[model samples]
Target: MYQHEPPTEESPKEYKIKHARIYILLLIGQVLFPNKSGNTIHSKWTQFVVDLEDCGKLSWGFTVLANLYREMCKSVDIKVTEMSGCVLLLQAWAFTRMPIISLVAPLQAPYPYARRWCIKKLDYQNNPRHHLQGYRFRIDHMLQDQFIWRPYLGLAPQRHEDSLIWSSTTYIICFHIVEMHQADRVKLQFGHLQGIPEEPQCLVEHHKMTTIKARQKAYTTLYSDEQNCWLHRELFMLDGD
Candidate 1:
């Protein structure tokens, strides 16, 4: 129940709190983890907003990243016409890690590192396909040293608790979608010496369960194995030097 007028000092405290929660929910759905239909938000996220106190403890960044990975994987199908998830995150990752292909100069911004690219003004390409081809060519020719594997080293907040799980090899659970966060596969990104990672986990069943028909099903029922894997993520973590 949102008010047309902005909450004033006279407004009830509960009403103000509810309004703030609503705003946050909208932001999460629209900007953070938007689906193919940009205008509508899935009802699954409403549970998180019901108790704002628990929000901080949640691995939201990991969830967003996992969703993006899942969406990208789905988009590989030639018949797939629409792509979902945060494309901005993808761009920011590319810009930070592959600076040679980045069109704009990096801004010296604080935490929430994606902001560094937000305020930039870039020249629009008349033909996007040609521009994409150029990016592909540049990426193909990129040297090993040219890639900034440890781009956010010393920039991430050391005190933040979430940083502990930055390199945790586990499944990132988002509702019915359970995607693997194979941190061991990208050990160099975490400033660790690359080693032969263990065999990848088979998640074919999880992928099959994340279809449109399965969206309404309970996440716990579908992803109990994934939840167990996440709980024991320390075992999966790479023992890199």
Candidate 2:
């Protein structure tokens, strides 16, 4: 996935290592945390790959979720031409929770529930708008009983154990990107009683800090403050008990 031409012969050890890092970054950009730029990997991710071994220790799932939330929010702007981030997550979420609109039946899989809809070569391009309107109509008229509020209930016990923190109300931080995980607002997803959630935390300044110019000027400060927010994230939860 590196931009450079392939070497004619076996590469040097250093060259091989560098190529591997580039490949990993490509996977991150194209799959995990894709942006609107398509295949163009951002330089900001270089620091994470510098110590390749430590990359596994990072909270990559949270980063993906944070970026996806940020991109979805940004898509509200009428001027925005393209949406980005791991949109596949959104699709998988919809398929799992809104089964009436799901094209394929979910498989009885263990964890990584997204794999259930791994049907290849499904033609969604045939009358795309018709499908879109159908989905919209279903969602718009969906009754509470038709929605699978707790779709994972029948999954293996181990899956539930592994996802204990899925309902955490906290700030998901990934460098300049920080988005609130307002789990309290969506308690039904976790089989909890729903209550009127308070107004969301004001993150306007933090959002502004993510701008290119602002990131250049205060990248360290922004990341530090985000990290601090994450560290004390329990305090941000709506429920005290």
Candidate 3:
């Protein structure tokens, strides 16, 4: 049983931007300290801030595995890379069953399993080949609930919430999924990245596409609800730039 609080009239349209700032910090950490390839083998602090909002946690496991499965499907167009991100995800799902997908309120625009992460521009002059070329090879993950959507930044690439529907309207953190359960833990185990769990389940290769599609459809319903409200209210951001 989940409980979501819809946006109130008083809620401003800047929350999405705030969420984007948090996401940027987390994504940076993932790239800098990816599994086995980076400086530190593991860091709890690094993990916590990744999702800040908690699905912001084991939900990533879901994302990794779901992504892996999604890529294999013929209908899915995007692709997740072959690296520790996927490996870590398998580890997490094996033990937790909590895919990052389950962390946000069911209202998020479901991540396109086939497509790569969304983005806007790049500072390639200072960045590496991966980001400059549209590759987010790293990610920071957390097991908390500290994020909400803000809709100030237009549908630029970096604004990774549910852009298709949000358009450039208000960006409020529409969903918050903090409570825990079996699925959450499973996603972590699936990733085989569990810190204490010593063993692996190796079940990442066996999920049904229906589960993946179900999650996506669910996300759509939730996102649509907000998008419709945005259209009616006409509460889009009004930047001076």
Candidate 4:
């Protein structure tokens, strides 16, 4: 059995600008090219829309997966025989039973199977296209968790205990194991970058379309190149007048 702290006040209201682009892109893609091309892979735009609509189910699934992960990590202290059982169960959960999807899919707002894309503005000056900084990717991922989906789920804010203890213990242990087996350990070099001061940019301040109809109108008018440029802007640099 898994236990979690009681849900407190509602989470923060957050917006995902990049996802709006994806929604608009899929909308355009469907209108322009409804039929499949020469490639064997078929587009999942319809299913993606359907998945987005299943927000409740997605949220529940996320809760279950979080508990399961917590329980698996807790099993480290059990007897040897029970530990063997835990190992098998962890393997099934982490591998055979579609671990990535089970863990990450619930975090998504509405889409289940959509290919994950990093929508952050890439830094070309410090880290070029060929050699990308791993930390940048990790930061982008962390922001996605903090800003994008977590808020959408309306999860309560984490308590001090949850933040300082349970959350850290469960995730670090479970994910560290996963990375140890599956990931290529890359030592990052952040020598001089540490001294550089942080610059905050307001990228999500786009024209607010409150209503669904208004949003749909805005999406129809939004050009792909414009969206790309807006998404890829340097976070640390302010746009010139």
Top lDDT model: 1
lDDT of each: 0.76, 0.74, 0.35, 0.29
Please report how far candidate 3 places residue 86 from its true position, in Å.
2.5
lDDT of predicted model 3: 0.35
TM-score per candidate, in order?
0.84, 0.78, 0.19, 0.18
Name the weakest run of 10 consecutive residues (lDDT summed) in model 2: 121-130
RMSD of each: 3.3, 4.3, 21.2, 23.8
Candidate 1 on 35-95: residue-level lDDT in tens? 8878888887888888788976787887898788888889999999998898888888887
Ranking of all predicted structures according to lDDT, beginning with the best and ending with the worst: 1, 2, 3, 4
Instruction: Itemize residue pairs with steric clashes in candidate 1.
Output: none
Candidate 1, position 236, lDDT: 74
User: Which regions of candidate 3 fall more than 4 Å away from where they truly are?
Assistant: 1-51, 54-58, 74-218, 222-241
Winner of 1 and 2 under TM-score: 1
Range of the 10 consecutive residues with the lowest summed lDDT in candidate 4: 179-188
Clashing residue pairs found in predicted model 2:
none
Report the Cα lDDT for candidate 4. Answer: 0.29
Stretches > 4 Å off in candidate 1? 1-3, 8-11, 120-130, 159-164, 197-202, 211-217
- Model 4 lDDT per residue over 1-241, tens place: 1133333345322224335435544443332222233222224333434434453233222223433443444465555222211222343332222222222322333322222222233223432233346434644554322322211124335422222121111111111111011001110111112233334222232222233434455443544444343234233122111
Candidate 1 residue 240 Cα shift, in angstroms, is 3.5
